[model samples]
Each structure stands twice: as C-alpha cells, then as structure tokens.
Target chain A: LAKTTQPISMDSYEGQEVNITCSHNNIATNDYITWYQQFPSQGPRFIIQGYKTKVTNEVASLFIPADRKSSTLSLPRVSLSDTAVYYCLVAVNAGGTSYGKLTFGQGTILTVHP
Target chain B: DVKVTQSSRYLVKRTGEKVFLECVQDMDHENMFWYRQDPGLGLRLIYFSYDVKMKEKGDIPEGYSVSREKKERFSLILESASTNQTSMYLCASSSSGTSVRNEQFFGPGTRLTVL
Candidate 1:
C-alpha cells in the first residue's frame, strides 16, 4: 500500500477555486487515485477518480501528472456547503479482488468561508 | 440509486456486553465491508466479505469478528464491548470484478457508545 500526504487543513472563500493536492510517492502500477468528501456526521462520498491526465465530473476536476506521484482535486466554485474533509486514496486490490481495502488517512479538511 | 443501510443509527451498550452491528446493501454487490472511524484514525477496515459466507480480516480486525451468512448482509460482532470500542461504525458495499472501479457505497453509519 502507498502512503499519502496531504495538508492538514485549507481555507477558501465563496466562489473561489480550491485545489487540494495529495502526494503519493510510492504509487503502484495498478493504483488508481480516488477522492472522497466527508461532511460532519456523514460517511465519505466519492467525489472523483482518475488514473492519469485529467478526469472531470459535475462537481469537481481531477488532475494527475505524468509521473502519477501526485494528484490535485479542484473545486471550481466553492461555497459554505462545500466545507468538508477531503480524502485522497490509492486503490490497491488484494489478490485481484475488487475490494481495495482502501487506506484512508487523516484527510485534508477544507473549510469554505462565506 | 444504490443504498447501503445499517441496522441502527445510534446504539448504547454496556461494558462486557456482546454487540452486533448489521449492514445490508440493496445493490446486490458481492463485496461488503466493515470499518470503524475515529477522530484521528480516519477509517480502518475491520472485515470484509467477498461472497456469501466468506470473510477476510482487515487492518484492524482485533476485538472484532464478522459474519456473512447472505450475500447482501454482513454483521460485525464484538464479543465483549469496552469503552475503547466506542466509535462510528460504517458499512460499505461494492461489486466484485477486476475491471470494476473501487467505488463503494457507504451506509449512513452507526454511532455506538460503550459505557
């Protein structure tokens, strides 16, 4: 399993673009970067996932460099409701199974100010 | 929409008492997982089942056991609950296949307090 490092906390204002970066220096070949957002008193929700290059969803965009050593989650227009803890995980399955038994680190907490 | 549901939203148990946490998924997913989340420890996998009656230990399987009698249901049992076992327990389910992405659907979670 690859260990990931992210900022402990980040702050942004309304309508600002917030970019959270995660560093995984020892990523494996089959590893895929996935991001999850967790609000207070709720389970983490899948935000976006990408292998390389860029992947965009309605809510956010994922940018992965060629080395795959790191990735960035970009929120186009932040809001008060966007305040949550964001997690970056490198999915690595055990014995070719679909379940990665994902390692969730102490994620980056994004605080959106009004 | 796919849904993963737990048996309880909140529970209170006494020390030395046996505790059971139930999780059910409606998506017919082949993989079901049990995880406990703490303030600084994030989410740690307790156990997971790939198929019916099949189980595997995860990162933090100590003091916790799981049963998967059916495909859609997985249960986590703590033989003797202790105050340290008190935390938010979350359940998740995902399909089984090498080609499928590891997008798990999570339940709302069960907040258990052991006194």
Candidate 2:
C-alpha cells in the first residue's frame, strides 16, 4: 500500500474547476491512483482511476505524470452539490491480494460555495 | 449496479454489550472489507475477507473481529462495546481478477453510538 498526502480542505465557487492533487512519493510501480468522493453521512464513491497519463469519466478526470509520484483529480464546472470530502488512495489492486482493504488517508474536503 | 447494504443505518448499544454490524453485497464480489471512519482520522481498515471463511487483519484490528460465513455476507463483531469504539462503520466489496485498477463499491454505512 502506498501512503497518500493531500490538502486538508479547499474552497471553490460554482462553475469553477477544482483540481485536487495527491502525492505519493513512495508509490510502487504496481500501485494505481484512485479517487473517491464522500458526501456527508454517506460512504465514499469511486470518482476516477488512472495508472499514468490521463483518464476521464462522466464526473471527473485523472492525470498522472510519467514519474507517477503524484496525480491530480480535475472536476469541471463545479457546483455547490460537488462539495464533499475527496479521498485520494493508492493501492495495489491485483486480484486475490488486498483489493478491498483500502487505506484511506485524511481526505481533502472541497467546499463549494455559491 | 453494485449494491452494498449494511444491516442498520443507526444503532445504539450499552457499554460492554456485544455489537454486530452486518454487510451484504449483491454483486457476489470475491473480496469484502470492514472500515471505521472518524472525524480527523480517515477510514481505517479493521478486517477483510477474500474467500469464504478466510479473513485477514487490517491496520486497526485490535478491538474488532470479522466473519465471512458466505460469499456475499461479511460481519464485523465487537465482543464488548466501549465508548471509544463508537464510530461510523463502512463495508465495501470488489471483484476478482488481475488488475490494480479494480474499484470498490461501498455501503451507506452504519453509525454505531455506544453509551
């Protein structure tokens, strides 16, 4: 498991793009970077995942550089409803290993203001 | 859609009483996990089961135990509840295969209050 470090909190307004970066200096080659979003009182949901380069989904995009030391999660045209705690996790998701055991670090809380 | 359901949304228990938090996943994922979340501290894994009757201790397994009697069900047990043991418990599941890209589906969470 690769330990992750991210901001404690961030503030953004409606329609503004929010980019949360997570650094895992000790990330292993087999480790994959994943981002999850958690609303109040609800469990976290997977946002986006990427090993390198860029990957986009309906909700967000993930950009990983060649070094793989850090990755960024980009949210486009943010709304107030997007305010939530964002968790950046790095795990070795190889099957039969520890796929379900995700070590979640203190996530970055994004507070979107109107 | 993968649906992970916890047995309760809220639970209250007395000190020293036994508590059980149940989780069931509909996707028949091969791996199931138990995690507790706190205010400042992030989610901490207590236990995980990859197969039937197979379990592994996670980072914070001191005051918790788990059971996987069947493929879709995983249970977290607190033999003696304490005040400090009160927190939000979450369950998650994922499929099997070769890939570090598999994502986990999480339940709504069970908030246990020990008084």
Candidate 3:
C-alpha cells in the first residue's frame, strides 16, 4: 500500500474553486488515485477517481501528472454544503496476502465559508 | 442505488457484555469490511470477508471477531466490551473485480459507547 500525505486543513469561500492535492511518492504503476468526501458523523462518499492526466466529472476533477507522484482533486463552484473532510487514497489490486483495503489517512478538512 | 444499512445508529453497552454489530448490503458485493475510526488514528480495518464463510484479520483485530454467514450480511462481535472500544464503527462493501478501481460504498456508521 502506498502511503499518502495531504494538507491537514484548507479554507475556501463559496463560489470559489478548491483544489486539494495528495502526494504519494512511492505510488506504484498499477495504483489509482481516488478521492472521497466525508461529512461529520457520516461515512465517506466517493467523489472521483483517476489514473493519469485529467479526468473531469460533474462533481469534481482529478489531475494526475506524468510523474504519478501526486494528484489533485478540484471542486468547482464550492458551497457551504461542500465543507467536509476529503480523503485521498491510492487504490491497488489485491494479491495473495493483501486484501483490497482502502487505507484512509488523516484527511484534509476543507471548510467552505459563505 | 447501493445501500449499506447498519443495525443501529447509536449503541450503549456495559463493560464485559457481549455486543454485536450487524451490517447488511443490498448491492450483493462479494467483499465486506468493518473499520473503526478514532480521532487521530483515522480508519483502522477490523476484519474483512471476501466470500461467504471466509474471513481475514485486518490491522486491528485483537478484540474484535467477525462472522459472515451469508453473502449480504457481515457481523462484528465483541466478546467483552470495554470502554476503550468506544468509537465510530463503519461498514463498507465492494465488488470483487480485477481492476484497481474498486470503490467501496459505506454505511452511515454506528457510534458505540461502552461504559
């Protein structure tokens, strides 16, 4: 499993775009970058995922450079409801001894201010 | 839509008592997992089941045991509940595929407090 590092917290205003970057220096070639949003007292929800380049969805966009050492999650037109903890995970295929486990780090808390 | 329902949203149990936490998924996913989240520890996997009657221990499985009698249901058992076990328990399920992009769907979690 590749360990990930992200900002502890970030503050953004409503109507502004927010980007949270996660660094996985030892990311494997087969690993994929995934982002999840978690609200207080609730479970984490899937946001977006990407392998390389840029993948855009209705909710967010993921940018992965050629190095694959890091990835960024971009949320367009943020609102107060978007204030939540965002987790960046490096997904890997399970093998004989390793089961598919989504290891969550100390996620970045994004506070959207109105 | 995929739904993962937990038996309880909040549970209060006494020390030395046996407790059960039930999780059921409607998606019929082959993999089900139980994780406990704390303040600084993030989410720690307790146990995971790949198929019916097959289970494996995760990072923290000392005080927790899991049972998977059917494909849709997975239960976590606490033999003797302790105060240190008070935390938010989360259940998640995902499909078994060859891709590296298996996204897990999580339940609303159960907050357990052992006194």
lDDT of 2 by residue, A1-114 (tens): 456678889999999999999887666567678889999988999888888999999999999999988899999999999999998877633345533334566788999999
| Error at A110, model 2, angstroms | 0.8
Q: How many backbone clashes does candidate 2 have?
A: 0
Please give, for residues B1-115, the per-residue lDDT of candidate 2 as tens digits.
6799999999999999999999999997998889889876788889988899998888889988998989999999999999999999999998863234678889999999999
Highest DockQ: give the candidate number: 2
Per-residue lDDT tens digits for candidate 1, residues B18-100, read: 99999999998999989898876677889988999998888889999999998989999999999999999999998984222
* Residue pairs in clash, model 2: none
DockQ of all models, two decimals each: 0.49, 0.53, 0.53
Question: Which segments of model 3 are wrong by more than 4 Å?
Answer: A92-101, B98-100
Alpha-carbon error at A70 in model 2, in Å?
Answer: 1.4
Candidate 2's C-alpha runs over 4 A off are A92-101, B97-100
A40-91 per-residue lDDT for model 1 (tens digits): 8787889999989999999999999999888999999999999999988775
TM-score of 2: 0.92
Residue-wise C-alpha lDDT for candidate 3, range B29-89, written one tens digit per residue: 9999999988756677899899999998887999999999999999999999999999999
TM-score of chain B of each: 0.95, 0.95, 0.96
- Clash pairs for candidate 1: none
Candidate 1 — what's its lDDT?
0.86
